[model samples]
Target: MNRSSARRPWHQHFETVGSITAIVVGVAALFVSFDQSRVMREEIRASIWPALQVDGFASLENGTLAIGLSVQNAGVGPALVERVTIRHDDSPVEDLDALRALMPPGADLSRTSLTGRVVAAGASVRPFELRYPAEESDDAIDVLNRLLSRWSAEVCYCSTLGQCWVASDDPGAPTMVDSCEGQPGGDF
Candidate 1:
């Protein structure tokens, strides 16, 4: 109605606009903080990622033919091996002795326990090794071929960050898992 009254209403409108702007800015800051936190978590997990692989080797050493199975850590972080399930024809192999029984006579066998072992990055551990005289290389080759066809090995491992995965000789292995608990097969 009067000049002073109209000026007062305009001042009030300015105050309301200021308040709304402040609220919008505050909400934007909160969202930015949450997004930054999510990115930080992803970076930390990537820094400690672990990848395990099962590999087989056949070589000649000191006049003996050696056949071996090894688990290698190829990721940047160490892998804590939780379980090892070795199978023959879809049935779990009980232990080192039981695995050896499947080999031919005169084939010397040795193994390292994989369960609860920590394999450092870029390191490897032989879980099974068999050696015999080079004179019997033919039979050893046959045995190795047969064993490879029927044998399978799966290793469940975790990273330092507590993420777990299952690695095996099968295709598309090294799948992410929730945890290594209740993995099948005897501890070996």
Candidate 2:
């Protein structure tokens, strides 16, 4: 071939290489986005809900402490749980693994001691009855306030993906996003 014709083949080769490189980069970017989305969903699933309010602590009926509470479900979908977790002064009293294993899929309330109750789909306030030993003390208000004062009360819910965490400043208030810069242990 002549010199001009030989140069034409080099130009075509350059064009082909460029096209392949562009396609590979595009595909790699798409995969990266997909992977990042998956990670975010899992983080949300494990987010903990901060307890905002717990009402009616004046009376204890036969070791049964009835209190109304509100919880925020920050996950993408509804949070369903069979066994609720009842923390003693903010400490976990129930074994998370055992509770999860016994929980029937879609079961809202726990058959065992008062721990976690089912919060409705996308619900902000979930009302349920909680019972604790009467010997526990009528000082429930003091205990609750102490727990709330710390401003770290969290509720773990079973999501389709996994457990997610959420938090709020006031226990008597609904949970809200713990701004990234504000709270130290807020997000996943």
Candidate 3:
């Protein structure tokens, strides 16, 4: 072949090389995009799962011994509570007022229990309280002891992504369910 004709093969070779380079670049871009997407999904899962715990304590609030129930979110995200059912004497105590009314006349209770609550990560909600002066620590102690024996609370909470859980002050580990629609803990 002549000189001009000989250059045709080199031109075709250059075009083939260019097309292969473009395909390799596109595949690399796709792989990088997939990796980034996977990482983002993992981060979202870590951010949305929540863990909550319920317990009681005798705390010093306003210079008085106060018996209180505490619910805390120890997870990475906020806990969206669907229901809080408090059981007393083997029955559902929907009204905290009724429990307060059962207390002695001198006992100071605010019915401030954290019910139907949403707790953020690393946050605590402690509302159920019965206050007693320092000299009346025995009253506080008695109330706390009575509450431990007579009361059990269950919290049905969820995550922002719609995952659900049931946590209880009763015996056994907290169980995770698909939804709170059919799963009601304790009496309520």
Q: Cα RMSDs of all predictions?
A: 3.0, 11.4, 5.6
What RMSD value applies to candidate 1?
A: 3.0
Report the candidate with higher lDDT, 1 versus 3. Answer: 1
Better structure of 2 and 3 per TM-score: 3
The 10-residue segment with the lowest total lDDT in model 2: 179-188
lDDT of 3: 0.73
Q: Could you tell which candidate, 1 or 2, scores higher by TM-score?
A: 1
Q: Relative to the unseen true structure, what is the C-alpha lDDT of residue 140 in candidate 2, on a scale of 0 to 100?
A: 63
Name model 3 segments beyond 4 Å from true: 1-43, 60-63, 111-116, 134-143, 170-173, 182-188
lDDT, candidate 2, at 32: 100
What is the C-alpha lDDT profile of model 1 across 79-127, one tens digit per residue?
Answer: 9998898888999988888888876778888778889999998998998
Better of 1 and 2 by lDDT: 1
Per-model TM-score on C-alpha atoms = 0.85, 0.36, 0.64
In angstroms, the error of model 1 at 39 is: 1.5
| Model 3 pairs whose backbones collide | 112-127, 113-128
Q: Please give the lDDT score at residue 42 for candidate 2.
A: 65
